[model samples]
Target: MRTDSEIKSDILEELAWQPNVDETEIGVVVEDGTVMLTGVLDDYRKKVAAEDAVKNVRGVKALVGDIQVKYGANYQKTDLEISKAIVKAFEWNTAVPEDEISVEVRDGWVNLSGEVDWAYQKDAAKRVAENIIGVKWINNAITIKQSIQPADVKEQINKAFLRSADIEANAITVEATEGLVKLFGTVHSIAEKKAAEDAAYLSPGVHIVINELEVID
Candidate 1:
């Protein structure tokens, strides 16, 4: 067992090893084994890595990441460029509905506000914003709407199979809404299950593909 201050110091020291993030930029507070991380990271990956590092540490009961991402002023990007990236994020990501989402950038911070049908889409939108060169932090204020029925989920799964080459479209069952495609039924192997998921991810409006297909022994 360690004191809160001791644990916080240890967490700060651990974050120093992460690339693209300086310890000076990181602030840690440990309250009864719950670690709260605060600081601005240059990229979202570094932020994620920082959180993961804290989780892997011994005696961490839970973690709260409040890492702020701030893009370098050295990187120059126009408002149009930021806007375009926001739109492209929606177009390329099947999970996010472009019509429902909105993006705004100010002094390197990206703010996203929208209503998505699932939690994953909100996550995806934030991820897209975090990937941009000048995005320092993302303020995601998106809401999750109602989900579709199980039958609708099956339809999405079938559509995913139909889009694939190897999988038998007729044999697979799908349940979908808000970009999460759940596949039910037997497949040849784990590889087939993965293949089905990959296909569904590439589908026009898919955010996540749940590979629920069981392996038949």
Candidate 2:
């Protein structure tokens, strides 16, 4: 375990290392391993980078990014304009299916709701929304449409884990029902745990993945 002061110093250094983020504008507070970040960022992407940088530091528990996104004068857009632009962008994006998603904008925050056949489509919708000017934040409420049978879902997940040289396949367990997959067991780190969860999601017909994999350093 690391002292609170040590953890704070490491987080500050990490934030400074991120070229996209302005560390001076961000404030860090630590108490009992929980980190709370309060500040203002020029871009939403920079806000996300700060969170990721904090997560990369060990001995950090929960993270709360209460940072605000400060929009410039040139980036201002009306709610109606944002709505129309997002809808048009979705139509132009090949990865996202047309008319499969609905866009709602309020106070510069974009709310996306709809169903898509693949995870990539859901991700694509958010990606396009994030790059748009004047978008303060985004709420991706997209769902996946899966029609794959539950049979062999477990075996396929196991096989994927086995195929990956970085994963310990035997240490993980898979359970599937209809369109949902549940993962149980332990992983060496957060990266390995995410890898296992990604494998579960990659399996066809897995609309929901319940990851109960514990991280053991």
- How well does each candidate superpose onto the true structure, as a TM-score? 0.53, 0.83
- How many residue pairs clash in all the candidates, one count each? 11, 0
Candidate 2: tens digits of C-alpha lDDT, residues 73-181: 8878899988888888888999988588999899988899988887667878898888777788999898887767787778888999999986899999888998888
- Which runs of model 2 end up more than 4 angstroms from their true locations? 2-4, 163-170, 188-192
Q: How accurate is candidate 1 locally (lDDT)?
A: 0.69
Candidate 1, residues 1-217: lDDT per residue as tens digits?
Answer: 6667776776777788776667787788888867888877666668867876775555565578898765566766776687687788789888678889988877666788877666667778877776677666678887655455545555655675787776776667777766556778876544465567656554445556677775332
For each candidate, C-alpha RMSD in Å? 9.8, 2.7
Cα error, candidate 1, residue 59 (Å): 2.9
